[model samples]
Target: MPIGDINVPIVGKNVVIAVLVQSHILFAAFIIGAVLIAATSEYMGMVTKQPRYERFARNLARFVVLLFASGAALAITFVLALVTLFPVFFSYLQNIFFWVFLVEAFMFLGQIIIVYAWYNVWDKLAYRKNLHVVFGFIAGFFGLMAMTMIDAVASYMLTPAEAPATDVARTFLNQTMVPLNMHRFVGNFGYAGFLIAGWAGFRYLKSTREDDRAYYDWMGHWGIIWGFGFTMLQPVIGYGYMKGIRESAPDAFDRIMLDNAFTFNLLMIWLTVLAVAATGYFVHKLRFSVRPMPFLRKLAIGGLAFTALFSVLNLIPADGHIATGITFLGGEETQIPLGGMYPWKYIGLIGLMLVGFFVVALYLRASASGFHWGNASRWSQFALIACSVTIVFTMVTMGYTRESARRVDNDPGYLIYKCITLDQKVVSENCPAVSDGVNTISGREAG
Candidate 1:
């Protein structure tokens, strides 16, 4: 078994799949995130009798409707590419997880129907706003289930259940499945929020009307609140997901975390960027307060300095021995890289997060005292735009890391962990009628 012997020379096949899958996930994530925001806004509108929240919700729902078809098309193309390029791998996954696929399909269908219906009848259902809100929840619920089903299947491919029998339930409940689901669930909100904020920021910049500027500015603020808030949960939840990977596939975990230093370092850079962007948004929101807050300003500035330093250190290659004294969380002690190669990233990541937390806390304290949303600087909006770009880049890097981790051994990647491997062999041609000790078919080697 030579390396790549079983793989067909389909040039750019992986890239094609990557682009389609990432695009599909991006669109789908936006829909999920929008649904959440719309639901929340509408509920608050109803409770507070605020027309602005109601209008915002309607606009977002309309936006979701516009993107629905494109998202679906991307999903269809992704599946087609998978089947055409890697039939064996696709079939293997389909056979083992058909039930999950079935559920996902139904949920996806439900989402389409529900989302469109909710969007189309927005004005008609104005009198029955409560019912409309319920429909929104229903649509979100369907979307969540669809996402969960797909995530479980993806997670199973990375860390298959530790069972000999091919029980569908057991396979679906793999160790990493739930954690991945949680991470993605949180990520959906964050990604969606940032994108919305970025759009609002752009609109704010373009608007000539003062009212329009105010509206977009407020909308951007609302989006950032959800975007940054949900993002904060990801580090903790992602740690759990990585722990599952470590437990289920120690080698794969090491390959992602320790062996591939650069990619993990890139992750650190993205995390630092996100930390800075998020904290910067916080500082911007409070920078113009009537009262002086010298302590908080200094804290935020220190955070930026550390983040910038971490980003610089992340650029250093991992082959050489780096100096280290001690490591601690949320301060300076650097170790426990989360799928990262460099040790200092551990410090950078934790410290950045701590700074973000304090920045958020200080903002809350300021809000309680006297800070108002009167007018945020355009520079602050630009910071949010930067956050959106970095978040998207971070997500793409994560996808690349996850996919690359599977093939770290430089052998044929596994379709189901140790049992079914991927390669170039055509299954129909190579499979034998009677089984020998070792069997090779469809690029899969089973014994």
Candidate 2:
């Protein structure tokens, strides 16, 4: 039976598939980032002889081990939903990416085994700390390999290589592949870090014991450092990613950067929230620093001011047209001042990165000197929570912006951007003539 002939109920097939995939992505991305962070923490514990680091690493590894099953289950369900709802599209994708899928599956299996082994042998290999740390790193490596394999497929869908699809190397190394991979690789760390910070903040608030409060307070500080540090690198990487999209898929780029600019603006708003909240946390925490450096605090406050200023610049729209049915200033679309992507937005992004670096540097200096951990204000903890919540919305908005770019003007759109239609039809002359030695349409040996 034709895959298109199968119709989903009132909610629609696209919505069902989207929900499953997005949910699965949230889990998968977290696991990948968490594994790396756990491994790093364990190594730090070994070198610094810090029990807190060890405790955090052990708990995180255990959490990853427990969470693995849920992530895997959701991944399987997403695949099943995709195959059932979009069989033809899935079939074509599978044919082109068979080896990639095979490699990803093995990587996933290897990650699971190593992660469990690493967690289970925590005490058994206490004497052999170096070897146990290697196991954790190995698990992280496997997860990253799996992520890389999947990224090739995702990037290709947006900016497919001009070469024949059967050209495996070219297909895998599509224009956007490396940038997309780097973006996600960095994003995972930031996302996981913010969540950890938020969790620690909540625990700190709930704890009655001084020791517990101190531990959670330190954890929150450590987590936010990782989160904010990695997030600073994203703007440049994301710009390169978007540049590739513009060069390869102009129509999609126009849809995202111009026609549907609101989504991109929303993304910037979330980013602004992240910067402001994280910087605010840093500035507040500096006030409780053991050494009491008023100069550093003032610097951080200045950095926060500049960060907010630049973020407002980024939030400005290129034009008054916000959405399909929306317009600003008396329902007439018009160009807005200081809103162009070239000079204004680029300047804003650079400014944000610079200010972010300055603030982080100041915060880290205070960290090296140490802070009165349990004495952090409630408002600072709330700032961490705000960052965590904003990051979730940022991820969702990013995904939506990227995918919606392909659906310009509510069109059926191409699943593979001009190569394969959403209905699973091959629409491009550049598409492979045959798949698995059979004609794609006729299902017979290619003449």
Candidate 3:
């Protein structure tokens, strides 16, 4: 059978792969972050003796166990699709990343074992709380290791190292690998946290019992702390990742940042919504704080205002041209003021991070004093739901932007940057050649 021979009807091959991969990522990322959060919660429960913390940890652990199978299935489907649609490219990738794949598989197996063991022995280990918490941490560690292994492959696809493909260390430690790993590392927590908060908010609204309401309210508060706290670091880490991309693969960077700038703009808008909505939620919740801290509430309001202002600045388009190559003003490219990435966007991003830190600090301080749980206004809960929804869109937009950067003027481009084309041909000096069932690199047969 010839490679790249299979194609789906109507929707095409790329869309199928994209959908499967993206869906799998959403699940996989959530699982990684959720396990870590559950572990931390369990430990805090043991130390602080808060029954609510223990309850949340056990419930979340159950959810993670249930969700694992779906994520794994999607991942398997994605691999099968890739092999079918891009066989030659997959072959090349396999030869180069065999060790990485092996490590990832083992890590995944370890995670499954430990996570189930962690959940199943919850009652048996109640007396041994320390050991139980260790199991959860180990499971989370395994999951993170798996994610790290995969990140190497994903990052290499975008920014292949200058060294030979056989140089495993160089290939795995590509230019963008570290920043990309950090971005996703922080992002998983933010993504999972917001979803948790959203779920808790919905449950809080529906709960009829006072105890259930209180628990759900507390859960919502805890989830938002993780979500917003991690999210505040994204802009900085994301910038470092982008800088690596721009330096290593300028063409790909321009494709997303300039040619298809609308996607980037959309990302900014989603991020802005995340920041403003979260800050507003904190401010609103402050009104019901157990202690009278009117000063902090007023400061939070100001923080929210500045966050919105910075977000608007970030959302401004650099030019009138949209993704379709159409200029809105119908002239020689109309440039929008306060839109350039240099001074204005940088200012916006930096200002956002600073103000986010200030706002989050105030919120945490007030949280230490405590809040009147189960008494939150409906609007505040709705804000949490809004943040959750925006985070979903943000994730989708980011995936699309990064992947679509490989597309050159709406045409299928390289699968592994300059090395492998989308149609499965190896096109670079660094790529190996297959001759008569033997792999040859630079005229020397590979072992």
Candidate 4:
């Protein structure tokens, strides 16, 4: 067959699926974060005599359980999609972390048992509240650990290390594993807080009873405090993450960061500023809940506006060159192209990110629309489904973006040629060494 006659795989479709699947993982991450906060708050509430905190904890825990189940289902779909589309990548991962999957399976089963017990026995076992709480904590903790180990195995692939001679333990226990775990853990906490704060605050507004409103407002603010604070520290973890990646694989780090490291670093700088500004807004709104704050509205609106613009500019153009569109008057390469200006992209994306939260906040703000107790609106249920769909699709898109950059012909560009076969024909896709007429792809390739 002519080199061009053989079609390249449908790169975009698989990537789109990958992005959606990724969203599922993120949903799970948020739930894990919520579980920790909810469980921790209640654990402390037990000793502190602060009934409001305990109340907040219970409500929040219920939310976490619901979201986690939804995320788990979504995650299952994501895995199945990966297995179907990218058998090679999946097989590669399974081989390296073979045992961990079994362990994760057990951990998941254990989690279900504990969570159901915890939720079901809220009133049945008052005497063993402490013990019951421990069960939930253990369950959440293991669930997180199992996920984290899997993540470690993944990050290791992106940043592999010098394997010592002999078995040298499992390859999954790579260097960046610990740092990556910490980073992910902190992210989980922060994200959970962000989600719950608005949720609780909304309910507090609708509450007729002064006591209920006060307690809920307090809870909402507290969740934000934890979430926003943890989120603010993301840069620190990110910095360490960069350093670790740099130390481990300077070449890979260089490629990831690019030749213009300082310029690329600008993305984080602007993102931090936006995040801090957002955090201040987060705190101020919750703190000054005596009345609605227009400033918060502007923050959301402005943020969303920026996000839309940024996403437009930064989105993977159907054709992959942000640089081509923005050229200097003269080709000395003196001036930065639009997206070429790093860090500034954050201003755009962070802006777009506001859309979801902004709507969520508004819904919560409309407290006087007459609310019912027990199982919210069909709209709420739909919103959950929407979140799941958006997350999974975006994850898929991300995968496409990454894979398109694979080394083809050892040169750049979509159709660049990589290597020649023994027969001297140009190879369009990457090929393995012809060792004993057997190929060794990192993952098990589908026939």
Assess each prediction's global lDDT (C-alpha) against the native: 0.74, 0.87, 0.88, 0.52
lDDT score of model 3?
A: 0.88
Model 1, 38-119: lDDT tens per residue? 9889989999896778889999999899999999999998998788777766776777788999999999999999999998
Which structure is stronger by lDDT: 1 or 3?
3
Q: Which residue runs does candidate 4 get wrong by more than 4 Å?
A: 1-11, 164-170, 204-209, 259-274, 277-332, 335-447
Indicate the residue-level lDDT of 282 in model 4.
39
TM-score of each: 0.83, 0.95, 0.95, 0.63
For residues 1-447, what per-residue lDDT tens digits would candidate 4 score against the true structure? 432222226665445565665667667776677777877887877887777667776776677677767877876877776565555445545655667677887877777777767777777766777886786698688778777766656555544433411122434565577777787788677666655655664665567786676665555546655655565455557668767766654544544444333323334333433343333343334323445556655665564455445445543221222232433445334444454434545444444345435533553463323122222333332332232233233333333322332322224322111222212343322322112243322111211
lDDT of 2 at 353: 93
State the displacement of the C-alpha of residue 55, model 1, in Å, after optimal TM-score superposition.
2.2
Tens digits of per-residue lDDT for model 2 on 1-447? 764667688998888877887888889888999999999999999999989999999999889888889999999998988888788788888988999999999999999999999999999999999999999999999999999999999998888766656878988888899999999999999999999999898898899999999999999998998899999999999999999998878888889987877888898999999999999999999988989899999999999999999999999887767777888774335778898888999999999999999999999998887888798888888889889888889888898888777675556587777667777777534444234353232111111
* Cα lDDT over the full model 1: 0.74
Residue 282, model 3, lDDT: 90
Higher-ranked by TM-score: 3 or 4: 3
Q: Which lDDT tens digits does candidate 3 get at residues 1-447?
A: 665888899999989999999999999999999999999999999999989999999999999999999999999999999988988788889988999999999999999999999999999999999999999999999999999999999998888776677778988898899999999999999999999999998888899998898888889889999999999899899999999988877778889887778898888889898899899989988887889799999999999999999999998888777667566775227888998999999999999989999998998899888888888878778888988899999999999988887665545487877667777767644343222343333211121
Spell out the clash pairs found in candidate 1: 6-423, 6-424, 7-424, 257-339, 327-333, 327-334, 328-333, 427-442
RMSD score of candidate 2 (Å): 3.5
